[model samples]
Target: MAKKEVLRLENVSFSYAGKKEKAVDGTSLVFREGEFAGIIGAVGSGKSTLLYCCNGLVPKEIRGKFAGTVRLFGKDVAKIGFPEISREASMVFQDPNDQIFNLTVEEEVAFGLLNRGMAREEALAAARKAVARVGLSEKLHDDPSELSAGQKQKVAIACALAADSKIILLDEPVSSLDWRSSQEVYAILSGLAHEGKTVIATEQDTCLLSRHATRIIVIDGGKVVKDGGVEVLSSSLIEKLGLRPPGPMSCGARK
Candidate 1:
């Protein structure tokens, strides 16, 4: 059977207010369910804007000039609206502090559920399961600000899972973490993908992207230059694009 497409961007382009250049220029891509996709690109390459467009944050909330079509689950995102799209797709920003504002970890995860009309007891129960998925069951009552950066990111993921989101979009999830911490977070995300969640994330670490991502997408100047499996990381195209080699290749592993 053919894979089901979860998100589709057809000839999509976006320009921010007062900006002459389009942040996302004629980008077209399709994301399938059960795939862990990594979007990699240089600074200002429009990877972030593309991610926002996946969940209707662009044009709808960000106030940009958007063209072309962005469809999530066969429904036009522009027509369905943010609240409807948000129920199926959740975005985690680079900074966990921005998302985790509640006093406790449980509160942090359950807040979304409560807002969506879930009962308090039921929301807490669901939050417990989500926290356990991220291996944070013991820290359920801990202050989010006191947790390490990586731990905080995990909490953000737990919030997404708690909300029963099918598609999770993350922007530069490990941009500020140490190597060990970054791996820990990716492992959790990988686990989520294994459990049938569509994990789409942007990352600068080619090594992690090569080893963790099931599909790698190289976006440059708001266009998808390459879309393939992990083997793409082993290709010479990395140098042509001015990207560092995959960690294994840099460490003398065979191409």
Candidate 2:
């Protein structure tokens, strides 16, 4: 079966407030459904800025001069507000602590649904199911404030799921997690991709991405450098690109 188009960017560029250089240079690309696209690049390469553009953060709340078009679900992001775009393209930031705030895991996951006017009991039930999907069902009543870094990240993902987000955008999701935790988070993302959601993430861990992401996109100097399958993570190219070699190309890479 052919995948459907989910996002398209046309000659997009953005310069942050007071910044001389464009954070996101003229870049264009298309993303399709059921794809776990892993974005990699050197520091300050505009990986995060590109994600912001997809969800209408750039030139919106961030207040920057943006050029070109970023379309989500065939709608111009610049033409809509965050609340409208966010429902389809939910963003998960680098720091889980920055995103989580509810007392219990259940409440944290249910926050978005409740905000959208879902009934309290129904929202909680949805939250429970979302939490279970992330393998954190046992911690439903536990305090998100005290959970491990990895667990907190899972709860954040659950919040996206409960909100029924179709495109999950993650920024350095596992930068603070250990090896095992990073693997677990990528595994969950792989599963989500398999279930037909578009999962895009900025990651420093190429090994984890090599094992899970269906597509690999490398960015540098605010533009896409290389974009392809696991083969793009080859040791030679990885070295040339200043990215950590992900060792052997794991056979587990999603199709």
Candidate 3:
């Protein structure tokens, strides 16, 4: 069966307030259900900004000179309400601290669901199921503040799951985690993709990105330089973009 198209961007371009150069320039792409896509680029390469465009954060929340069209779930994002767009495309920010605010992990997970009109008991029940999906069932009642960086990141993911979002967008999710913790987060994301979520993440580490993401997208200077399977991470062009190409073992091992 053909995968459903979850996201589509056509000639999308945006420059932040007071920015001379476009953070995203004439970028076009399509994402489908069950794809664990990695957007890899060097710092200031516009990968993060590209993710922002997925859920209407580019021209809506963050004011800028924006051009082009972004379609979420086949509907133009410009025509959809921000709240409606957010439910389909849930964003996990770089810092878990930014997403975690409620006292208990369960509450943090249920926050978005409740805001979207899910009943109290039902949301908490969904929260438990979502937390377990990320292997954090035991941490449900614990304070999010007391959890480790990776666990907090898991909670952020669980929040998205509880809301029943089909598309998950993350920005450098493991940037603050230890090597082992980063591995765990990547594994969780891959599992989510297998479970039918269209998972898209922005990361600077090509090695880690290559290890997990089913597809690799290269972003440079606010544009998509390349887009294809995991093999692209091993390309010489990756080196020309000022980013390290993955080692032979990793390149050989990633699907």
Report the number of the highest-TM-score candidate.
Answer: 3
lDDT of 1 by residue, 1-255 (tens): 867889999999999988888989999998988899999888898989999999988988898789999888899998996667878998889999887789999999998888888899999999999999888999999999899998899898888889888899999999878888888888888887888889999887888877778999988888888999988777887777778877654433322
Total backbone collisions for each predicted model: 0, 0, 0
Q: In model 3, which regions exceed 4 Å deviation?
A: 249-252
Candidate number with greatest lDDT: 3
Global lDDT for candidate 1?
0.87
What TM-score fits each model? Answer: 0.94, 0.94, 0.95
User: For residues 128-219, what per-residue lDDT tens digits would candidate 2 score against the true structure?
Assistant: 99999999999999999899999999999888888888899999999999878887888888888999999999987888887888788898
List pairs with backbone clashes in candidate 1: none
Ranking by lDDT, best first? 3, 2, 1
Lowest summed-lDDT stretch of 10 residues in model 3?
246-255
lDDT on C-alpha atoms for all candidate structures: 0.87, 0.88, 0.89
Query: RMSD per prediction, one decimal?
Result: 2.1, 1.9, 1.6
